[model samples]
Target: MKEFALIAELTRSLPKNDTVVVGSGDDCAVLDLGLPDQFVLFKTDAVVEGMHFLTECEPEKIGRKALARCLSDIAAMGGAASSALVTIALPKKFDVEFVKRIYTGLNEIAAAHGLAIVGGETTTNPERVLISISLLGLVDKKKCILRSGAKVNDAIFVSGELGGSLAGRHLEFEPRLAEARWLAQNFQIHSMIDLSDGLASDLRHILHASKVGADILASAIPISRAAKLQARAESSSKPPLLSALTDGEDFELLFTVNTKDAVPLLDGWKKEFPKTKLSCIGKIIAGHSLKLHDKGGVRELSAKGYEHFA
Candidate 1:
């Protein structure tokens, strides 16, 4: 089955559980902790051989990416990471030193982030290497951001640049957990999501949840320097804007806040995250579709970034 179809089917088949504060369709599943101000955010992600990484790629980097991807989900919720557990599937003919390096990479990052690697299962696959990490985090119930809170006229913003992940940023990108937390504490962020699936596709998730549309200005879209350089080199007809629109795996944060507070947030962001880039590319609308404001015209957004099915 296609990725999204399988996701929908599973979401429907799963029995509703009352303990889930925010369930399927979000970056993380928030569980009720029965505390007035706290919620638990849970996420798990995997990196597989030949798909997520080259079979010849360093095993250590592969292990690091597996854990980082799951941690990105926690950052999307503006949560404080707590701990992690890992599952590994290795080929029967694997070398011991190679496995040790993989864990070495994973342990290094985990220690830096204070994410304790508690326990996990390992098995022999005899075909491909597969590493999965389950991450637990804590969020303030009052401050936790979800994709469903966007309101009409809310300003949309994205952190850092987008596109050209294939140029190598994807493997070494840092999760914006610190920035997300700072934003939640300082600004009234209405809704937030990590830009793992590109702006066009991921923004749709916010629209679906908030029952709102967005009007994105083509000129205002933030194009990463890497994407611009790549576009120039490719000499392809696709514009840099297209790259910024469709390139997934950026791992940046896309969020929305009230128009009134947008100015202050932007003003404070400079002093707070001096090296990070932030852009206001759009505004939420009352409808249920995305419209792009191109030069002298408007058009509906097209199939974007990477989707497993399409």
Candidate 2:
């Protein structure tokens, strides 16, 4: 079965309470926690040796990627990360220096983000290394963005360029925490998500949650230089456009706002983040089918990002 299908089945009957404002199916599980002005954001992410990183990959980068994944989810909610607990499962014959180097990377990012490393556990996996990070964040009650908020005619936007993450961008990509917070504070962001699973798959998540669809202009998507280079360098590689649609781990912020707010949002972003590129690529529509508009007119978008156990 596919990863999403398995998740749906497993979470179908999970226990819940009144405090659970937003649970499963979102970038983060939000809890009302009785805070006067803030909601708590909870997220957990895991990285494996052979899957997320190569065995020869630097341990420091590997650790950074593990924590960065959870941070990106928190950013999707327009929240500030607070603390995290890390659990590492290693083989019986693990290297002490490698584990210490991993912590070096993890600590550096955590400190930079003002997030504390609380506590966690160490276990034996008997095979490859597996690291899981459970992160906590907080967002103002009124500023928290969710996937279910997209509306008809809302403009969809994405931060940074997309695709070619496997060429080293994935491990070094920074979480869009500052950008997301700025967007939520300056504009009425309707919905948002981080692009970890590619534009096609991640955008579908917002549409499904909002009970809507989107019409994306193929020409408007900002493809990365790395993606273009990869396509030209290898005959067997996917085309740049397709790579932009399906390459996972972009880690950029994808969001929506009122159509009227589009121009102002773009102008403001240009001034606030001169180094980053934000693109207005599409618009939300009233429907259930995701469509791509290009020189060929319109067609249903059947291509999707990578999924586990598909």
Candidate 3:
């Protein structure tokens, strides 16, 4: 079973909040303040030693990734990150210098994004290292984008390339803060999300929330050469392109805009930020399932984003 299905099945329903602008399925949960000018956004993400990091990976990178993962959610909401709280569960064998280096990495990224580390907790764990970060951000209430706002005829867009994040893309990916800011200031984005999970799975969140479907063109997905190389290095039977489709942790932005407004906005985006390539991969439709069209012909796509207990 896919991740979302399990979440819907196992998790009990909670009282819905009218203040929630975007909740549960997107990158961050946004709360409305009722003030015409401002809204608040919150997000939480956790990193586990065995699941999210390699045993020998640099302590600094691990720390940076743990924090950056949450910041990416703020970027998705077009919000300015304000403060963060970090909770760490340290294993028995952890050293002082290791912890210090990890804090250094986290602080570096936080400073770069103008976010302050306000408070947190430290705990002891016998088995593995775990880090959880929660972030608070602010946005304009009228301007906040949501996953449920997508229209049937909107054009789907993705920032940067996709796939093979396991080959170091996850470690070094820059959060799309500048790009998201530009998008918020200049364009009318209908909905937005960060592609932490695979594109198929993440896109499904928007579709399901909006009660729509999508027709994605496989040929249009932008793939990095690094992703192709990694796929070739890891497998011989299946095309590396499949890895690009299935591999998660590409922290790029995936958003949608009205079909009429997409072309001009895309042209401006290209002229402004050439490094972050933008690609139009699909269109929203009036249905309940996702379809992918490729050389292999049309097929139903599965929503298989990364899940903790999968």
Among all windows of 10 consecutive residues in model 3, the one with the lowest summed lDDT is 301-310
Candidate 2 has what TM-score? 0.97
lDDT of 1: 0.86
lDDT of 2: 0.93
lDDT of 2 by residue, 263-282 (tens): 99999999999999999999
lDDT digits (tens) for residues 1-310 of candidate 1: 1787889987886776789887888999999978778999989888888878876767777777788888888989989889998999999898888888889889877887888999999998979988989889999988899999999999999999888887878788888988999999988899999988788888998998999999998889889888888888997645677788888889999999999999999999999999999999999999997988876578788546322211
TM-score for each prediction? 0.94, 0.97, 0.92
Which ranges in model 2 have alpha carbons more than 4 Å from their true place?
303-310
Give Cα-based local distance difference scores for all models: 0.86, 0.93, 0.84
Query: Which prediction has more favorable lDDT, 2 or 3?
Result: 2
Best by TM-score: 2
Residues forming the 10-long window of minimal summed lDDT in candidate 1: 301-310
Candidate that beats the other on lDDT, 1 or 3, i.e. the better one: 1
Give me the displacement of residue 76 in model 1, in angstroms: 0.7
Q: How far off is residue 241 in model 2, in Å? A: 0.4
TM-score of model 3 vs. true structure: 0.92
The number of the candidate with the highest lDDT is: 2
